[model samples]
Target: MDIVEAVKTRRSIRRYEPRDVPKEIIVEILQLALNAPSAGNRQPWRIHVVRDYRLKELLTDAAGGQMFIMEAPWVICVVAVPEESASRYGERGRSLYCIQDTAALITHILLLARNYGLDTCWVGAFDEKKVAEVLNLPVGHRCVAIIPIGYAGEPRKDRPRKSLSEIAVFHE
Candidate 1:
């Protein structure tokens, strides 16, 4: 699908088929995510792809018992490396751009996955400290989102979004 179509169709897929996604496919999707622009070109985002069912179940529990994470074939943990951002932008940069940049990269990954006939869900509601422990993240790396990816078990319905006029404004 084209970019516009992909953006329009991409939804947070909560239910996934009990099928495995190829390693190469996941790699390609991550590469696409890496293409996202970052503050000062620091590329402060890191991704942890979790495929083990047992670990996924553990992560699901850490993510507030979201069972869908365990059902999906794969989960990706997006993290913000503050040092990378700080090196380029200073203290304020670490606190601000690092997280936003990581989020943007994850958005790119989600869109690319959708374009590739895959489904993904970006999970932000989770215990950051627990997630860091679960993933064994290093210090200064903060967990931003947990994404579960696979083929859709159920069809996606349109989610209500604010109209452009309601969300956008023009300066006179």
Candidate 2:
């Protein structure tokens, strides 16, 4: 799908079919997602692809019983390594730039998944400490998002969006 189409149609799919997304396709999407721009090209993101049923159950619990996490065949945890960015740009890089960079990477993953006829949900409402422990994240690294990816179990309807005037500001 084209970028515009993907942007318009993408939804936070909460239900997934009982089918598997091929490993090659998942790797291809990750490869493309890495092209997302990073601050100072530091690429402060690390992706953890979780397919284990026990791990998914733990993730679901970490996300406060968001059961859809277990329905998808794959869950992707996007991690941010602040120290990597901080090495080049100092405190601001650690606090802000790394987060922004990983957010961009997450966006790439969502859109690229849609391009491959896969469905995903950008799940961010999880206990950070719990997720860190569940994923065995290194010290100072953070899990920015938990994405459940697979084929959709049901169709999604477009939700309402704010108009450009309500959300945008023109400087010139």
Candidate 3:
């Protein structure tokens, strides 16, 4: 699908079909997503691809019992290593640049999944400490987003969006 179509069609799919997404496809998506620009090419993100049922259950609990996380065959945890960017850009890199870079990467993953006829939800409501423990994250690594990816079992209605004029600023 084209970028415009992908953006328009992408939704926070909570219901998933009982089917599996090919491993290669998932890898390909991640590989392409890595191309997302980073602050000074530090690539402060680390992706944890979770397919184990037990781990998914743990993640569901960490996410305040978001059971849809278990329904999807795969859960991707986007980790941000602030130090990676901080090494070059100092405090601002740790506080902002890493987050901005990871957000870009997350957007790429979501749109790329849509291009593959898959659905995904960008889940951020979770216990950060619990997620870090569950995923065995390294020191200074933070879990920024938990994405559940799969084939959609239900249709999603479009959510309302603000008008361009309402959200955009003009200088010219």
lDDT of 2 at 126: 99
Model 1 clashing residue pairs (backbone): none
Candidate that would win on TM-score: 3
Question: Where does candidate 1 stray beyond 4 Å?
Answer: none
Reference-based TM-score, model 2:
0.98
Off by over 4 Å in 3: none
- TM-scores, each model vs. reference: 0.96, 0.98, 0.98
Q: For residues 58-156, what per-residue lDDT tens digits would candidate 3 score against the true structure? A: 999999999999999999999999999999999999999999999999999999999999999999999999999999999899999999999998897
Candidate 2 C-alpha RMSD relative to the actual structure: 0.8
* Candidate 3 lDDT score at position 43: 98
Quote the positional error of residue 135 for candidate 1 in Å: 0.7
| Clash totals for all candidate models | 0, 0, 0
**Per-residue lDDT for 1-172 in model 2, tens only?**
8998888779999999999999999999999999999999999999999999999999999999999999999999999999999999999999999999999999999999998899899999999999999999999999999999999998977888899999999999
**Model 1 lDDT tens row, 51-159:** 9878898799889999889989889999999999999799878899998898889889889999999999999999888899888999879999999999998899898
Clashing pairs in 3: none
Off by over 4 Å in 2: none
Worst 10 residues of 1 by lDDT: 52-61
Question: Residue 64 of candidate 1: its Cα lDDT?
Answer: 94
- Backbone clash tally (model 3): 0
